[model samples]
Target: MLHAYVLYGVAGLMLVVRGIETEQRDSRGGASWNEVITDIGNERWTDYYIRCLHPDVIRPLIRGDLPKRLQDPEFRQRVSASLNLHATPGVYLCQFHQTGHLQPGDSQETADTLEQRRGAGLTLRQWLMVVDDCRLYSDVNNPASRNLAEQIDSAYRTTRATNYASNQRRWQSGTRQQNFAGLEEFLNMMDRRWLNWARAQLGTPNEWILDVPMVRAPAVVGQSKNVTERASHHLALSGSSYVHSLISCIVKFRFAYRFDRSVWQLARVERPDHMNLCEAIFSILASAYTWELGLNQTVSGASHQAGSHALTASALNQIYQQNRDENLRLGNVDKSLMLDEQLVQRIKEIKAFDKIKDQKFAELDEREKRVVEKGRKMDTAFEALMAREMSGLIRLQHRQALEASRAAPA
Candidate 1:
């Protein structure tokens, strides 16, 4: 009797394993294993958005064709109001049509206009914050529009005052003569570093061409020996300012481009190359902004330098953290685990068992949460490893420089 009981126990264990395998196989029926594998390997929210906006295999769904459930009337109203779409419907429509996205048009011209507007807005907001962070625009007697207009006026005055001072210093020194050279230097540095960093992050060298030229003031008035010198100066200053403004706008445009590219890459279920590119660009921008704020402090001779510095630092830190979180959320591991017949069979079996039992035991929510957490941890670890690698490279470069210096008998 004891021998018979042992044989029955072994048989029961074998049956249980077989049943589980059978259940898995049933659940995965009718599903494309290749697609499942791709989804698992390329986990990214941007990928969904990219496909929705610019699909390849299936022509992109038109905006009008989007499901009603996805279109929130209230959100659309808010966006319309904030963007002043009512006043510029045609312009916005043309922009959207050209860019192939529903988002506000970010064409080169539009970007310049937006930057000018943004600068105006930022100046007004900063002034209001100084007056009263909470109730700066709460006066019933003063129209909000009028208040904003006044703030912008004050800000421009302040900017002009600072610019005039700088111009005076340039005139006093021989530096004014070299303004064109300085502009060239600035443009060269921006172009070289921006392209290099962009290429590194994209992992596709030579994909883009940096064709924008260094801006310079127009030749002196009547230096042409034909026109009035005063008029020429006016034209030169205006032209130079326009060029500077456009370049600044391009910087913002590049930010938006990378954002869109990241989404596209995700949609195509490509590698994490774009994420790396986004991170690198964000880092460079943060570093540049920090340096600019420091220079602002030295030039302004202001007591609130520390506070401004902290604000700028916080903004950069926030951007970096946000990018890191996004990268973590989008990254996928176990990509090597392809969607083969075995995996498909296993999934099918699980689904069939759940259906037969009339009670879900797969615990999909729990499983998904565990997977996401694992991916986040893996991303963080990878970032840390890269940071260490960069540090090592820097040290090696420093050592090489030191050896060269010693050998040169400085």
Candidate 2:
């Protein structure tokens, strides 16, 4: 079962979405009913925000199966506020658009700009999570997962200050910031390891990162695969599987929350000099969220006039590009069209042929000349195709920019 995560614009919260599909196989090879730690985001939105939002359902979900360290009342309160949409919109809620999705022209109300207000009957975040505490993999035998699990666990330990009372004080004073320096390092580590796969599966690599520092272990994520179908099928998807060999690895996955700005949220010009990975990702999502909220229109003092001409939505991608901050530029644009391995190969082949076409045309024998002629024709087709592909991306950018301007409050 995959681990489901839903981030709310309320309270910068990330909630697990579902209970898993199957339980464990016993020593006798029997399946039993194991109530895994269910994710709040996995529950039906109506059920979660409605029924579960009720004191009864929420009381149990919060009080149930919590980690020993996370079993306090403060943790329950943190999760509660995090899950509440009406009260807290942390950064921006990640959701599936339902039948009732709102469009730019359709929304005349300010509340319509909120992410929590833009879903179907209820908003659902598309993700899943499974629990596996099987002592199958340990530090000695499996350092990668062991290290990751510990790191995430440690990150959680740092969030003990995320109580309702303390959070309010910090929010008002902007004085408290819980630092998980290790989490930031962990994200950089992931960038180095999964840069290629991430680019292929997700949008342009490093463009809009969900810079997950250390995913809880023994859980697989259901996501778009950019690799060959064969490679994807042959490969198991898990935190450790990508980093190291997945055989006989006992992985454990856990959850943590922070009251302060430990989780970083980043954008084009918004990248911080130092921050937790969670905070960095949250920064980008928050930028998209603010635009989604139409709050970008109200900024004053300096940037207000430019706000009229300012880019919107995920246009922060363009904003970053305009500033020429090339290495760092991830946002909410789910760019499915990737210029990866296959396309690069084609571009290189066409360029090679184009380079030699004139020289080879004069000196080559008939058979060789014929080959050169074929390559020249292929290059023509390829170059045009590449141009069109690039042009399409430019058009997409234009469209996003136009939408941003249109969505801005007049």
| C-alpha lDDT (0 to 100) for residue 354 of candidate 2 | 48
lDDT of 2 by residue, 20-138 (tens): 12212122232111211121232222121221122232223232332331346675444332222122212222222222234455555633443322222111011112111222112
Model 1 Cα RMSD, 1 decimal: 30.7
TM-score of each: 0.17, 0.16
Per TM-score, the best of the predicted structures is 1
Off by over 4 Å in 2: 1-42, 45-109, 115-181, 189-410
Distance (Å) between predicted and true CA of 394, model 1? 54
How far in Å is the alpha carbon of 353 misplaced in model 2?
Answer: 28
Tens digits of lDDT, candidate 1, 1-410: 12322343312222332344345436654333322233223322222212221121011011122223124576434222222222211100000001223245558776654433221111211212222311222222345523543443233332322223232221223343343333343333333423333335343432221111111111111011222222212112221222232222222232332211111101111221222222222222222222332312111113323323222324433433443443344352231121222223434443554474453345676688899999999999999999999999999999999999989954
Model 1 quality (TM-score): 0.17
Steric collisions counted per model: 12, 41
Model 2 lDDT on a 0 to 1 scale? 0.29
